[model samples]
Target: MSMARTVSDTRLIFGRYLRQTLRSKVAVVFGLTQPLLYLLLFGPLLTRLGGVRGFGSGDAWQVFVPGVLVQLALFGAAFVGFGLIGDLRSGVVERLRVTPVSRTALLLGRVLRDTVVLVAQAVVLLGAAFALGLRAPAAGVAVGLLFVVGLAVSVASLSYVLAMRTRSEDAFAPLLSAVTLPLMLLSGILLPMGLAPGWLDAVSRCTPFRYVVDAARAAFRGDYATAAVGEGALVTVVLLVVSVALGARRFRAENA
Candidate 1:
């Protein structure tokens, strides 16, 4: 009965944000524009590089698109905290606190909405990639999409937790950039980590995001059954669990 109530509240909150997003069509288009630009501009230049040292042979788009998709997930989901901060400032969160909605549902609803938005962006990203020259098996493409949504869930939860803790966009924005840039750079989202110096490559192994990027690349290459894919999926699941738990705990503590 308690579980059913939580689910019902989550659906209600989810519907509220889903409708809000639908009303802002420009935000949806702009969320996809960065990846699309990278696909058109930076992508062609990579193809000219012929063979990157550690990257396997393929049309560069096959390699580049997965990286861009993950970047899309990374940048978009990590910034979701800004919206939460806005809610807090506008008293939206304070108003919700008086209601009986599950605190977990509050965080889960926002993260789930973020997941949906990022998945839509990923679809548009893949469409542009296909037009450019990317060709992965449908199953592989599905895997990549799953990876994107998993990443969205994990990142968005963590972002919201940080927003709650900081309670100020001024503090949150720079801190988020500091956290995300290092993760993005070391994760090899743009280039293979193998190309980095031996020690730098070794250091990347410490970041969970590296596993996710590897998993997406494996799926892009149609190597779904590989060990790397298994490790990547494991890392992503663990991240989602830990992040959601942290975010929910923070929300409950704040409201309590």
Candidate 2:
């Protein structure tokens, strides 16, 4: 009964957001345009900038492509929290607080829906990348799905942090770019981390996105290294926990 109620409540919230977003033509365009722009522009541009080191295969754009997809999924999910922050400031959070719906369910549900959409968007981008010579191994589909899952969780958590901690969605808007841009820049998104400056490589080592790239590349190749999986799982778990913690605290404060 409890699980059922939770599911129903979450579904209600998810439907609400999705409906609103879908109704607005501008919103749909903005969301789709992100990956499309990266696909059309960055695909050829990076491929043309000569050879960049690969994770292992040295295919240049191939290794770089997965990271870009991860970045896109992360950024795409960021807007869900922007919606959350907007709702909160406009008293939607307060309204929901007075209802019987679970706060965890409310936030988690949004994350779930947004993550799904982001992953689907990534498929389009990855397809475009392949057309531009970014070929994955035969296991590309499976690999991409796994990578998107890890990415969605990480971004959803970070988005939770943004929505809860920041004063408003507008205030948090620029920070989305701030957070994601570095994750891509530091990670082997456009070039192998080995080619990056020493400090940058060290920093990328600390960034979870780097682990995602490593694990993803391995997964794409069907290599499935234990070390890579462990690292990615660790970071994903830690970040998601932190997000829930912060979100809980903020929700309490808002209702208090």
What is the per-residue lDDT of model 1 for residues 1-256, given as tens digits with 9 covering 90 to 100?
A: 2888778888988998888889998988888888888889899888876586787666667677888999999999999999899899999998998888888888888888888889888988888888888888899889988887888899999999899989898999999999999999999888878678999889899998888888888898899899879999999999989998898889888552
Decoy 2 TM-score against native: 0.84
Best by TM-score: 1
Model 2 local distance difference test score: 0.69
- Residue-level lDDT for 130 in candidate 1: 88
Instruction: Provide the global lDDT of candidate 1 against the true structure.
Output: 0.87
lDDT of 2 by residue, 1-256 (tens): 2878778887888888777766765865678786677667766666555554433554556566666776666667666677777787788777887888876677767777776677667777777767877766767547656766766765776676676777576778888778777777776765667677788888889887787777666566556656876676677667667766665555546442
Tell me the spans in candidate 2 whose CA falls farther than 4 Å from its real position.
45-55, 252-256
In candidate 1, stretches whose alpha carbon ends up further than 4 angstroms from where it belongs are: 254-256
Native-to-model Cα distance after best TM-score fit, residue 173 in candidate 2, in Å: 2.7
TM-score of every model versus the real structure: 0.96, 0.84
TM-score of 1: 0.96
